[model samples]
Target: MGMDNKMIVSSSPHIRSIESIQSVMTDVLIALFPVALMAVLLFGYQALITMVISVATAMLVEALWLRKRDIYNDGSAAVTGLLFAMVLPPSPPWWLVVVGSAAAIIIGKQVFGGIGYNIFNPALVGRAVVLVSWGGYMAGNIWSPPQPFAFGADVAAVTGATALADQGEAIQYKLSDFFIGNVPGCLGETSALALLIGGIWLYYRGHIDWRIPGGYIGTVFIMGAVFGGGFYDNHLMTGLFHVLAGGVMLGALYMATDMVTTPVTPAGRLIFGIGCGLITMLIRLWGVLPEGVTYAILLMNAVTPIIDNFTVPKQFGGVNKSA
Candidate 1:
């Protein structure tokens, strides 16, 4: 018995910290505080109700699926549920949210063999499903935030204005509002400040690979400048809005960082980030949809295997004879 006990003890990925799945997931949720608060302030009870319903539905679906598979527990479902809730708009119906969550856990994740085996980010898959199925509802003209959650009804009501609706005139917005997250958009994506805080926290904890975010944001900025058409006004900020206003921050920070879906090699990660950025830009600028981050990430998810094959580290003393 003593010998067996000694054999059972082991060490050596030697770094240790007081973090667990619950702790990390809780931290992520906590980090989302600013955005969640901002979202409730801007959107209202409708958005809040939708988020609650969506997350609850996600958890239920995950539990049911796991029970079916005979696997006891996994925290991924909770993460997926919360992420799905965050990306939805203020007005999406509850049924759509439920269906999207189901699809995320079933088709996008479990079918591919669950958690570490999945090839794509499940939350984005769910968001993409809803976006495709309910285009008009997802992108509506009435995007005013809820007054009850916001400090002042008058202030929340001001978010009703949007730039994309107009043909020639530009919609002006205060940078402070955008930063602080008082603008009109998805539940969690409204506040750049909150997203940045969360992202910084994730980075500090070493739970994420910073290369992916750095590459994605950098590519968007550079491409925005190249295609901006003008020098100062229309170029960078518009692209930045595309980055800031939708699921880009959430995807870049959380979804894109998923170890299973992303490339293993550093170079492969760079490729993945660049591809995500390009596709997002194309969809926003040229495609019919106003937002493209979710689809862009999923599309790149499919191509990660190819990127990894080409960029993975070489074996010792390996030689390239094909040249």
Candidate 2:
């Protein structure tokens, strides 16, 4: 008999993407540079320190969990950790951050069978867990930029102020300050310009599905404008402030674009994004929380699988009731 040697290998789509998981993750990190640099510039060294601590903690937790679980050759943990660090407020204490990172790596990722298998965005789940468990600590937004170089020693001793200190009672910033990230908030969330630059890069690279961000931002604008009244400059300004602040840009560009946690089809993704936008606006206008992007994303993440099921590509010559 002729020597028989055949091998069978199967993978997704049968068509290869020029992108590897590591490369995609790397590109994401690169795209974030502009925003990260801007955040550091506006918020100071402490912001950079926060990012480093969060990312480091995330990486350590992810690696340890993977080692414990016996599946040890994926780069996803690094991505999750980096993304988590990018969204956290600068004032988060080290211990709370460590807890969040561990939650992201362990319960959010490895426990779900790693990487692509997770049902939710690991970073968001981790952040959410911290938010629920340590509401007071996590809500501390007292962050300040490095004192000017001339101020020297004072820089080390400065305490950060709260982002929402003047809200309701009085609006302390112009719409412009909020848009430029001059007003206090999460370190990374201050600059709409920087986030937009990063978003444009990701869109150019085709790494992101623009529908999600577009729909999300657009829906928020329309809804916020309607409730707050009209899309004229003043109303639009308020909407812009809301859109550019907090984790809106970060979530739209990074977390909301999570391939595994978001709907696969274009329409489904559009619907998911619109829902996020609507919920964010509703919560911001009337809910207890001042910002709602993270919670909105997580709430929608729960519905993504259902969206995918309904939006799956139609079988050839089959009924398309899902339409």
Candidate 3:
């Protein structure tokens, strides 16, 4: 046989798609457009400013770290920055945004060796840092109400608690408000409608797995319906409220589904999602914080390797360890 006809076997991953990291990250950014647009429409220019600063800081930090002139390296830094902004208050101090974005790219990402090597989601790491360091700004009754296309409006003037805040037996806003994202919350987390649209786009592109989101949202709904007090109309509605409110939609569809940090095995992915939901509900119900999506995902991220090890399927005709 000719040399050209001979088999040229290489290591694993012989079958690879044409996709690159830049392409994958670009798709994520496109999917997040609706969430970003909704943030601006709901919270006005302040949200836009927050996104700009965060994205700029993240890209700048990564560029400087790698000693590369290309600020948009693989586009992962931009995604991390935008996601970090999504978890933030609509109008947090500019300095805080810069610090958190930088932290996300540095400590959360590069410190672990960058992108696919990082164990935790960079955006959540940044948010967790800010939340711990500046709890007053990140939590409490500081959420700004949406202005609904009032681009020039000052949202900060009318601050209030989110629907998820522990306020006894009555939800403050209508279910419609939560679905439409008119209620006060984090910049991108308010609008379930927007997130659903983005999720659909990601799904269509085959960028995400339904098992993770399904298991996560299903667990949250079940736990909410069972344990959540019948605060809003009925237990069913309360469960639905849990699904639509705060970062449940965002975390389930986006953060928890991160390709790099999450597991590769299907079973591991499902378990990861369920674990995230369980921890999030546990924190929201019993922990000190009103929101728990960030920490829940981070904690699950730490155990991803263990989950994958046990969940990986045995190869065909492979011998059993006990045998």
Per-model TM-score, in order, reads: 0.83, 0.84, 0.93
- Sorted by TM-score (best first), the order is 3, 2, 1
What local distance difference test score does each model get? Answer: 0.71, 0.71, 0.91
lDDT of 1 by residue, 106-188 (tens): 88798987777888888888887887788765663555543546443443244453333322222355556666666666777
Instruction: Score residue 15 of candidate 3 by CA lDDT.
Output: 92
- Which scores greater on TM-score, model 2 or model 3? 3
Model 3 segments more than 4 A misplaced: 1-16, 168-170, 316-323
> Which is superior by lDDT, 1 or 2?
2
Query: Which digits, one per residue and each the tens of the lDDT, describe model 3 over residues 1-323?
Result: 48668788899988989899999899999999999999999999999999999999999999999999989979999999999999999999999999999999998999999879999999999998898899899875778878899988888888888777745412778889988999889999999999999999999989998888998999999988998886778999888888888899999999999999999988889999999999989988888888889999999999999988888766689766321
| Superposition error at 13 for model 1 (Å) | 7.1
RMSD of 2: 4.0
lDDT of 2 by residue, 51-119 (tens): 777777777776676554522234566667667766666546778777887788888877878778888
Flag the better candidate by TM-score, 1 or 2: 2
Q: Cα miss at 300, model 2 (Å)?
A: 0.3
